[model samples]
Target: MMKLYKKYQSLIKISFFIIIFLISNNCNSQNKYEILKSKIENISQNSTDNSKSSIEIIEFLSYMCHHCTAIENILNQWQSSIPADVILIKIPICSNKKSEVLQKLYLTINEINKPYLHCELFHMFAKEKKSITHIKDLNDWLISKNINVKEFLELYNSFYIQSKSNRANQLAKLCRIKGIPTFVVGGKYTTSPAIAGDEYECTINTINYLIEKIRKE
Candidate 1:
C-alpha cells in the first residue's frame, strides 16, 4: 500500500511540473504581442462584413521612413509566402504634406493598376536618396517609366485620390500611429520592431505569432 502511494505521489509531482512548463510557454507566447484597445477599436467596430474569413495584417508605413525602407525587402518576402487566408494591407502614413503626396502616389499607383511602380518608388527613395516632396518631383521619373504624365497627374489630383489620401490620414490619426513601420495584426494586436525588439526579424516573428494566435481563435 505504501509503494502504491509513493508511485501516485511521483506521478502528481511529474504532472505538476508539466503543467508549469506549459503555462510558462503560454505566457511567453502571449508576451510577444500587445492587446490593442482604442487604437484599433474602430477597425472591428467599423467592419461591415462578417463573411470574410481571411485575416488582415495592416502595415502602417511611409516611403520617407528609413525603418520602413529597411524592412521592405523582408516584408515583401514574407508577403509572398503568406497563406491564402491572410491579406496584407499597406497604408501609407499621410501626416504631412510630403507624406500626403506620397500617400496619393500610392493610391494613384493602385488606381492605374501599376503595382510594380510601388517597388520602383521605394527604390528611388531609399537607394537613390531621392526626395519627392512635391508631385512635380515625379514628373521626370514618371516620364522615364513611360507613364503618361498628363494621365498620371490627372489621376493623382482627382477627387478619388484626394478622398483616399484623406481617409488614409484619418485612419492613421484614429489608430494613433506615432511611428513608421508599425503593424496591426488581425486588428487585435499591434507590434513593431520598436515594440518587439531592435531586430526586424523579431517583429516578423511577433507578427507571425499573432497571426497564428488569431487563426487558432
Candidate 2:
C-alpha cells in the first residue's frame, strides 16, 4: 500500500509539470505575435472619412519598392481568405514620377477582373527590372498579355481612376507615410514589416490582432 501511494503521488506530480509545460508553450506561441501601440498610429480625419465601414485597411505602397513587392506576394495568398467585413484598399505612394503612373495603373487594373496580373506586374517591375515609366510602356505590356491596350489606357487616364489616385495620395499624407508597404488598419492603426521584423506572417498576424481589437471596440 505504501509503494502504491508513492507511485500515485509521482504520477500526479508528473501530470502537473506536463500541464504547466503545455501552458507555457501555448503562451510563448501567442506572444510570437504582438501589437505594438507605438508602431500603430492614427492618420488625419480627412484620410479616414471615406472609411465608413467598421473595419477598413489601407496599404500604402509603391510599385518600385521591393518590400512592397514582398508584401504583395504575401497578400496574394492571404487576401482571398480574409474576413468579409474587412475592406482592403491598395493605395500607391506617389512620391515620384514613376509612382504616379504606377498608382494610376493599380486603380485602373483593379477595375478589371484580372487578378493574376496584379502580382505579375509587380514581378515585372521588381524581378524583371522592367522600367514601366510611362503610359506607352504600360500599354505595350498589356498588349502582350492579350489585354486591350486602348481600353486600358482610356481607363487608366480616366477621370474616375484619377480621382481614386488623388484621394489615395491625400490619405497617404495623413498616415505620415515615409515608406512603402505600410498597412493602416481601421484607418487608425498602422503596421509594417519594419515594425514587425522580417516575418511577413507575423506582420499579418499583428494586423489580424488589430482587426480583433477593433471588432471588440
Candidate 3:
C-alpha cells in the first residue's frame, strides 16, 4: 500500500512539474512575439515622410563592411524578390583608395557573363576573410579561373573603371554617406534599416511602408 501511495505521489509530482514547464515555455514564446511586435510597431511609427521624395530606394553598401554584409546576407534575397515596379538599387560605398577595385569587379562580372563570380568573391572576402582589398589580389584570384592577368590589369586601369569609380565616389559624397548598410528612400532621406528596426522583417516593413507612402502621393 505504501509503495502504491509513493508511486501516486511520484506521478502527481511529475504532472505538476510538466504543467509548470509547459507554462514557462508558453510565456517565453509569448514574450518573444511581443518583442517582435513592438519592434514592428516602432518601425511603423518611424517611417519616412515619403510625400516629398521623387526617387527610389537605394541601399548604400560596402563589401568590406561587415555590417553591410550581415544585412545583405539576411535581406538580399528578399530585396531581390521585390517586384519590378519597386525601384531598388545597391550603391557601393566609395573610398579614394579602393573604390576602383569594386567597380572593376562589378563591371567585369557583368561584361564577362560571370555574375556568379561576384557572389563567390563576396563569399571569399566577406565570409572567408580573404585579402581582397588590393587590385592584385583580385587579379590573382581571377587568374586562377583562367582569366588573363594582363586583361585584368588593363581593365583595372582602364577609363571604364576609373570613370565609374569616380562617379560612385561623387555619388557617395553627394549623399553625405558616413556609414555602410544605410538606406536612402527617394534620394532625400537616409535611414539605417537595422537601427530603425529590430529584425529583418521590421527593416523590410519600414521599407515597404515608405514605398507605399511615396506611391500614394
Candidate 4:
C-alpha cells in the first residue's frame, strides 16, 4: 500500500509538469503576427478597381496630441520605405477649437507642397511650447518662417481648405477612431505603438503583415 501511494504521488507530479509544458508551448505557438480580430475590424469593402487596389493606409491623428507628435519621425521614416502598392494618407482630427487650427495648417502646408515644414510645426508645438490656437498666433509663426502670412491666411480660409477639413473629419468618424496617432491598415486593422504593445516596430510589422494577408486574399 505504501509503495502504491508513493507511485501515485510521482504520477501527480509528472502530470503537473506536463500540463505546464503544454501550456507554455501552446502560448508560444500563437504567432505574434496574428493580431486579435477584436483589435481590428472591416471598415468597408475594397474597391473593384485595381488602380485603387493599393493598400490604403490612413493615419488618424491630431497635431495637438503629444502622442501624435512622438510618432512623427517614425512615420516619416516608414513612409520613405513604404512599397509602391501602399498609399499613405493623413487625416487630421478636428473635433475641437485647437484641432481646427491644426487641420487648417496641415491642409495649407500640404497644398503648398511644403511637407518639410511638418516637423517644424511639431517642434514648435511640442518643444517650443507655441500656442497656435489663435489665428494671430499662427500668422505670427508663419511670418517668422518667411511664409507670407497674408497669402497663407487667404488659402487657409479658402473654401477649398474648408472642404478638405470637413472631409478629413468625416473620414475620422468613419474609421471609428477613439484616439489620436491611430494607424488604420487596409481600412480594417487599426493599431498604434500603444496598441501594439508599445512597440513602434511591432506596429509597423503588424501593418505589413495585414497588407500581405490582404494581398493574398
Off by over 4 Å in 4: 1-51
Model 2 residue 216 distance off true place after TM-score fit, in angstroms:
2.1
Off by over 4 Å in 2: 1-53
Against the reference, the lDDT scores of all candidates come to 0.79, 0.75, 0.61, 0.76
Poorly placed runs, candidate 3 (over 4 Å) = 1-55
lDDT of 2 by residue, 81-171 (tens): 8876676777776877777988888778778878677788888888999868876787688888999887888888889998888888877
Clashing pairs in 1: none
Would you give me the overall lDDT of model 4? Answer: 0.76
Scored by lDDT, model 2 comes in at: 0.75
- The 10-residue segment of model 3 with minimum total lDDT is 34-43
Name the top lDDT candidate.
1
Per-model TM-score versus the true fold: 0.79, 0.73, 0.65, 0.76
Error of 3 at 129 (Å): 1.4
> Which has the higher lDDT value, candidate number 2 or candidate number 4?
4
Query: lDDT tens digits, residues 1-217, model 3?
Result: 9999999999999999999897555433112211111111011111353322234667777667676666765666776776555556666656646754675676656556776776676677687988566766776787788888787668767887667666666666666677777766655455564455434444566666566655776
TM-score, prediction 2:
0.73
For candidate 3, give the lDDT.
Answer: 0.61
Q: Against the correct fold, how does model 3 do in TM-score?
A: 0.65
Model 1 earns a TM-score of 0.79
Tens digit of per-residue lDDT, candidate 1, span 44-124: 222354415667788998888878988888999999999876778888877667788888888888889988888878888
